[model samples]
Target: MRLGLIKLDHQQVSLAISKLDERAGEWALKCSTSVDLAFPTWESLKSQSLQAFSPPNQAYRVRSRFLSTRQGCLTCLRQSM
Candidate 1:
């Protein structure tokens, strides 16, 4: 993706992977790619800068609220009721 030879949007890649799953009703599909041995190591991974993005605390709170609501967790649901 970083090389840009075969560009794919995030959602497109995710959907393709979901379809590749045997549980998603497409059993025969599979992903294949040849990664060069020269590719960067996992320990060298670094996140993209997001100075413009919202703070971590704000994002964590939002996700927590959403999971609490949608997943019907015992504690969260009990608290809400």
Candidate 2:
């Protein structure tokens, strides 16, 4: 799965994950921004794999913080399960 994050505003960010399609040569939507943050098709997440070459400076920190928080929450949830 191909994951992405887009900063919408100061308080919001749009996060998504799509399936890689070799035939279509584009990502197919697997899941989108949701409260549960579910991605059924997601296999593994690597730090380097998520990095962007050149991203908007203003949104970088916001996105990073959001993702970091989400990752922490996910880790907690998994441990509880």
Report the number of the highest-lDDT candidate. 1
Which pairs, if any, clash in model 1?
none
Each candidate's number of clashing pairs is 0, 0
lDDT of 1 by residue, 1-81 (tens): 232343444433343334444432232122124111211322211121132234768778987886567444466556668
Candidate 2 residue spans exceeding 4 A from truth: 1-56, 70-81
Residues 1-81, model 2: lDDT tens digits = 123343332112123323334532122223335423432323322221243223547477876665556454485335557
- Best candidate, TM-score-wise? 1
Cα lDDT of all candidates, in order?
Answer: 0.38, 0.35
Mark the regions of model 1 whose C-alpha exceeds 4 Å error after superposition: 1-46, 70-81
Clashes of 2: 0
lDDT of 1 at 81: 84
Error of 2 at 34 (Å): 44
